[model samples]
Target: MQPYSHARLRHSWLPLRPCPRLLPKESSNTSDAFDTLIESFAFPEKFDFVDIDLGRIRRAARAPQARQLTLHLAIRDAPAESPAAQALSDLDAASFKLFCTPVVNLFQRDATSIQLTSTDRAYPVTPEPLETGTPLDVYSIDAVRLGDRTQSEHEKGASSSTAAPRTAVLPYRALSHGRQPDPTVAYWTAFRDPYAAAGNARAPILLSLIGLDGGSAQVRHPQIDVDVTATNGDLPSRLPIGAPDSDLVHEGAALACPIRLLTQPTLPCSHARGHGALWRVVAGLSLHPFDLTQTGLKAFKDFLRLHAPRTNIVAQRSIDAIVGLDHQPAMKWMSLDGQFPSFVRGIEIVVSLEESALRDVTLHLFARTLDRFFAPYAPTNSYVQLIIRSSQAGQELHRCPARSGTRPVI
Candidate 1:
């Protein structure tokens, strides 16, 4: 994983959209504490960027009792070894985007700072905000680069301009802060099937609770019969659900299909609202179910049926043998930097074998490759027709005119 960082912007980063957050009940003590925390910590300069949406600020008002707030900002397709490396990665030069979300009350505070029990790391929290400061902690970061096939066109008349960034001030209310019995037990048990295991299963799927209440927490690994739960000392009754992980996949035949992994976090008591981001991941295995094999077979069948309908050897033993041995093309995800969304990364296709294995190498391969190639100048309303021929005496190759709706031959 390579560390990547966003370039420091001189302005804020929030777009002019309606922020969706609820405000907390106001109290003099809570306001004083929050204001003091904001001022003392100087959070804006400390964080690479901040979101100051009014709704987020209002939501934080509910966390008056919260001593500290833990933030996890997720940047897609950007992975780094450390914060310093992440800061040096040329995120500005790459085609990518930075999406930041807030996580509330993930730490316990001693007297002067916030602490994490699991990692045994403490972060300093002051009563005043710093004008220019360093980040106290670096949470987890994961990124995926999208690909673009049309490089020549992509380079033609390219523009390197961008809009200014923005920041938002979110008031993350103290949600539930206790531990509960691992409710993921049932989910984990379902992952234990031998058939599912044979399918390259994703085990121990997690479903965590997240919301405005400080609630009990739990961990259940049903596949192995393990359960662990914990709770906060002071406000045990009013806590919310646990934090959730990404969805568990039953890898196998599903890998050959176009599928998306969606993570739905634990909901609030209201059943309508919650405090978590739904992370979407593109899932595929390299050389497992052979999605490309399936695609190639389909395309070969099309060529045989549509282009060569009179051929009687389509189902012969040799055809089957070739199909059995043929390898699928390779596909990869890439980034041109800030171009397409997560769903639209650049796609690359590679051809390895010679077209001679089938019929005519040059003509067929050219036609297929051209049809598959990504280009800005792709014909909008035209089609390509290919033909192959073999000659023993001719020393030169030449294209011969063919009648309308007929394949061309040399």
Candidate 2:
């Protein structure tokens, strides 16, 4: 129902660039070469600002007059501050030098209210006693989180493991609009899995930093604190919240995309700009490896089909079976001759007539032929191939094979 601004900083400080080779003949793959060039030009994490010079590009235009250009800017966390904290801050444009670590488990002990206390004497501190050992100096909010019920057939089938609960993180950031930034973070909120979907899904957590951004730094405000009281009603549905490393083997795999570096021109407002950049980094890394593996599997399947026909049929059946198609007729055709391959699992036969004869005589002979000539060797995987040369001709030469595997005696 509501659009959420992401709090995380995506790695977009990298942008795509063109390859040096002008012709396809000069490079292995132009697209890949271009991707490399993009990576080469990727910006370091430290620079988050970009300036637009419209005057420089408008040389041909009569209005070469200089105009102030509006640029969309992204700011990285200050070196003294951690990116994780920037994600959690409430100020629109506050700068912190401390590194913020991501908190995976936000559900600790529930607090009835939160108190903000300054770590430094220069900053105002709330007098409220925090949960024991809750970091001193930082505004501490004691809040309560509760879970509600889930109803569904799937929930009914869920086992105890499915109902298991875990801690969720609530991420927040501060932004400045027009007034002085609030010194204390506020409006803390988080999302959790409803009891039914508890173990199976991830939970979203969102917290609002009350009024930390606006205006100039000269307008100092008192340190604000929140007293989060618990409620008996249902936990709310909406809260927004927001990788591991693999040692690469030979540059590993990469997804083709443009990347841009982010810079934090202003401290408190960095998240408002940096979130999109952080998302790009994460998306590229996640899909690259999966794409590589899928390509390999498809090529292997194609190779099998080119080398062996028998194996190809068997493998095709196996693949079809995986998609839930079974009991279809097998594709093996055989003539009256006994020649057949070992791979075939079944056979069929068709009988035909040769020359003209009396109707009753033909009927009787056909029955006798099947009983006396062919029925005896039914256990063997062999069958008669009856060929009818001409219907109007008189009785033609009749031939039958013997049980010793010799040519049919005429």
Candidate 3:
């Protein structure tokens, strides 16, 4: 309703110059070469990371030789403190240094993994071309990370057993926007069942920092609001808030995004911004992950489709605006074969498309299919209703247990 200058910073996957390289012809062990290159880089002494996000590698099997090294660098943007003021401060732009220790969590054990931190920051970043020759040899040392899991009791339990406490770190791959929550959920999904056996189904207890991107550094701000003048509710507040090894907050607040919050549960997703009517439509499907009803069915199918993107009947361009998913998974269950996803418990859409399952699918197969005809990547999209029976607005939905018990799913 209102267009406010939401606080935001200029973030970019800096493409450094003089990229370091080792010709395959020059070395037999590219792994060793990778180690040597990532162990440390002569980054510009002036520009250091306010924060950094290790992103996924854009690996093109077609062109394996030249892999794009993508990394996120946070600019020093503080409220009231203009770029000119930051230049005058002690840690000014002219002579910046990155503190690599606590900002990232890289859980990899290979050539691709390099020891990084405030004191032992590594990665040979250069502006100019450092290596010559294609068919080059490059070794990925480890998985890159961006969020800090040290605070997450569950994530801590999962990581602490094998490695030392890790800070948030993104992988050395190029990413335009930060990692969304779905990927983060998928990230946690990789852990052994016991880790999440206790409290994994609920929203993850992660210290999501990047979610607070735009807004004053002194005080946190919300991304979207029904009316800021009347209710200054921030959508990002739904994310867990705390100060554990962070430069922002009480000084440099978090920089969060609205889109990233959609992946989490409706509690934070809706309460954070105080937009229940709005998010209920977007996040209603999230309620289905562990259940099997209404929007949940669509969510199940969406998760399945996420695993195999090719089989999705809904056009990629139209998914976010997907109309309410059919309460019943198409009983025919044509494409899925017999297998179902394991992350969620219950009937695998729990209504598994058996003849009985068709009972559910038949309800909205045609309408769900018709939803695809509407608008696109732009805003002002159509709304998909939830299958839940709650006729009242701004109310929470409840359902029965999604599955019988925890059984090993292949």
Give the best candidate by TM-score.
3
What's the ranking of the predictions by TM-score, best on top? 3, 2, 1
Give all candidate RMSDs, comma-separated: 29.7, 34.0, 26.2
Query: Order of all candidates by lDDT, from best down to worst?
Result: 2, 3, 1
Going through the candidates in order, what is the number of backbone clashes in each?
78, 61, 55
Candidate 1 structure quality by residue, lDDT tens digits, 87-178: 54644534332454422212221121112233322122221112234112111101111113332234336654432211111122322223
Estimate, for each residue in 294-342, the C-alpha lDDT of model 3 and write its tens digit.
5555654454333222322222322333233333322122212234533
User: Per-residue lDDT of 303-355 in model 2, one digit per residue for the tens?
Assistant: 22222233223323322211110111122344335564443323122222322
Winner on TM-score (1 vs 3)? 3
Model 3 Cα displacement at 242 (Å)? 59
lDDT (C-alpha, whole model) for all candidates = 0.25, 0.27, 0.26
* TM-score, cand. 2: 0.14
**Structural similarity to truth (TM-score) of each candidate:** 0.14, 0.14, 0.17
